[model samples]
Target: MNAVNWGILATGRIAGTFAAALRELPDARLLAVGSRTAESAEAFAGENGAIRAYGGYADLMSDEDVDVIYIATPHPMHHANTIACLEHGKPVLCEKPMAINQREVREMVEVARQRDLFLMEAMWTRCLPVIRRVGEWIEEGKIGEVRMLSAAFGYRTGWDPAGRLLNPGLGGGALLDVGVYPVALAHMVFGGEPTGVDAAAHIGATGVDEQTAMTLTFAGGGLAQLACAVRTNLNQDARIDGTNGHIDIPIFWRASTATLHVEGEAATVINEPSGYHFEAAEVMDCLRAGRRQSSLMPLDETAAIAHTMDRVRSAIGLRYPMDA
Candidate 1:
């Protein structure tokens, strides 16, 4: 109930964004930061107002003062990092694509349950108020029986074979990076795993997907068209088309506004904040109530999404080292 003491496990760009958001919450305190090196940890702590810095991740995890940890390490390290935190008796909020594949994700989930520790994949978009409103609209039948959807998230980045976005060794690709956003959105709207996954990708010189397009079929005849790319720009919008009406979300992943269009009625527009703080708030609320997993972003669903991604990768012949 007291101010939640937080520790961040990495000093990457995403970690910095999350750290800034935590600073805005009066009930949350940035207590410590851990990185591979002392200098980087100290630098992040100084910039982010953290009270302590640990040169090694193990040192931070062992700190009894920290209540929970936010794992912002690269995609390949999520499984190990999350398990370490749980083993240290700390809850975790791991960055999404929870792990490189389903097996790793399942392992992480199992460990959390075994340890009786709170663990959540940091799919921050799902915690946005606007997204919650969208869910309400669907449940209220404002969109009728949802039948089809389309979503795309993409941006062009200059080629750098060794950069995180292009390096296969780093578990880099459009699907894992930007594509997961659209995939997760579809899963939320459809309410379960897709029955079918068909996909195509342009494997770049670095042996990772630079662009990917997928068509997923859900039970009850629902369909979703999704795409992600790191070598091209996309509209970054989404549409959920139901039998009677549809909803349009612009920049849907970090969506702040959406419009509802019924077959024969005026359109309704809604807006809300879309910050990293919402997910952090969810973690704290769960910790306070003694819940081990987020109802909104359940561990089972997180693993299901990873399964779907595995299928997508198999379809496009994309493979990461962890997949083997």
Candidate 2:
């Protein structure tokens, strides 16, 4: 298998992780890393063996040697960065929460569809093998008719009002950061958008949400109860209950293990690999198959989740600095 020439579009922590892990894949390679500053891009790309360091993102996007561009920029910048990549006719795997708003997501989808380019919101969790196995078990009736889900993700963020967790300008708050994991998890297990949504939040001094709790009622007679907090760390366990049994993912947000407990049977531990490799593998798989979008991370599902999140943001009265 020939390696895909990957490009890292930002010098952030995720960019480094993806670059480092892609090297382990053997069939994937990092060709370039781009940053606003040449020094940072050069340093990052050099550290990861990328042949090119682009001082500007446009240089990376226009580089014919690159196969896919990873958009690791902030949520607020995702709109502009992804559009720039798509406009230049580059395949993109924009980071989680897809974009700062539903409108931004719609535009990204439209451009990609119009250009017939590959694009997906890199919600890496969907690619986890363990998550796939969990889905399999649910489909096989390990848990019949999932009726309820309880999940929470939180962290003691040290309360920096100007930091990404609290800055409205950065599209901060628990909902988009840690909260997205739980919400996405609910969607993954349930396999559809929430028909009803209710949410509440406590806004920080910077006007970003410090903590948020949401209840999403799915059409299939199940409810997902989720909570996220930047003010404190949650135990981060998730549970899915059904008529006859339940599965518990103790480390819900970034799970390494889950146990299924049948009504009259012993709990079974399902261990899984721990890393960002799965998401990269998905990218590799899609590129090799000449896919424009991931069926697992389909655009419609991404849009529905964004729509649900928009409602949650609206109900919490959360407004980012660039919301207009």
Candidate 3:
């Protein structure tokens, strides 16, 4: 197909963002949208300029014109939704954290592989131009043998016991909600699972972690200190310290600028567009190329990150209702 026909499986905030980004790509068509209700689906389709709207996910799935589906459902629903799309012979770009745990991620990956269909965790940061530059800087030895990393992603959402950010049924918590950013960053820089993980969390009255801190020790002696909180405000900055100097990324998750500090040299700034279109472009390219997974954000990497999150949750004694 010269142009990819996209189907959005949710009408939430993230789904809107993905739909808007898809509009920025010339080879992408926002063909269909689906929601739990016909009204919601029609509203989203009208707002996003989709050609068709379905009251239920199955209806959208049955639309053979949709070449791929973007699963923007909450974390708790990722497994079922992704599997459903793959089973229908439709490729998927599921939002992260791909699922609530590693086991679910593995199952999703297995289905994609078995069906020879495309499936990717929509960790948009992994496809950002600034992040690609960071990778290149690391490879060029600009940060000479990275030794330490520090990052945090947090916002002052206050406390809402029944809200999605604190609801156990929705897999709500700072870790899964925002903490995945720093953890994914660590993996991108360090390149694998940590040798050891030490963590602690503040489980609020809602039975979800309001704030959590972790220290990941890599096999090569590198360390990453990361934190995420839902009830507090944080710098939301990231730094990579190396033998020579450090690289600082402000608002790291969706960073547009990164500054590299080399020993006794002036800081150099790298900048790029901080939009979701890069990931969408990557998805279209992968589809056109007939690839099942992204090299930059592989399924194995997605599962490994889920494993790391599981370890963090274990260390903090945070259990979701779905874990049982």
Which candidate number maximizes TM-score? 1
RMSD for each model, in Å, please? 0.7, 1.3, 0.9
Worst 10 residues of 1 by lDDT: 163-172
Model 1 segments more than 4 A misplaced: none
Deviating ranges (above 4 Å) for candidate 3: none
Clash count, one per candidate:
0, 0, 0
**Candidate no. 2 TM-score:** 0.97
TM of each candidate vs. truth: 0.99, 0.97, 0.98
Give the local distance difference test score of model 3.
Answer: 0.94
* Model 3 weakest 10-residue run by lDDT: 156-165
Scored by CA lDDT, what does every candidate get? 0.95, 0.87, 0.94
Better of 1 and 3 by TM-score: 1
lDDT of 3 by residue, 1-324 (tens): 888899999999999999999999999999999999999999999999999999999999999999999999889999999999999999999998999999999999999999999999999999999999998898899979999999999998956778789998899899999999999999989989988999999998888999999999998899999999999999899999999989999999999999999999999998899889898889888998989999879999999999999999999999887777
Q: Write the per-residue lDDT of candidate 2 for residues 1-324, one digit (tens) a residue.
A: 388888889998888887877877878888898899999998897788989999998999999988889999888998899889989988899999898778889998999999899999988877777777787888898888899999998989786777777888899999998788888888888888898989999987888888999999999679999999989888799999988899988776567888998889988899998667778888889989999999778998888788888888998998876678
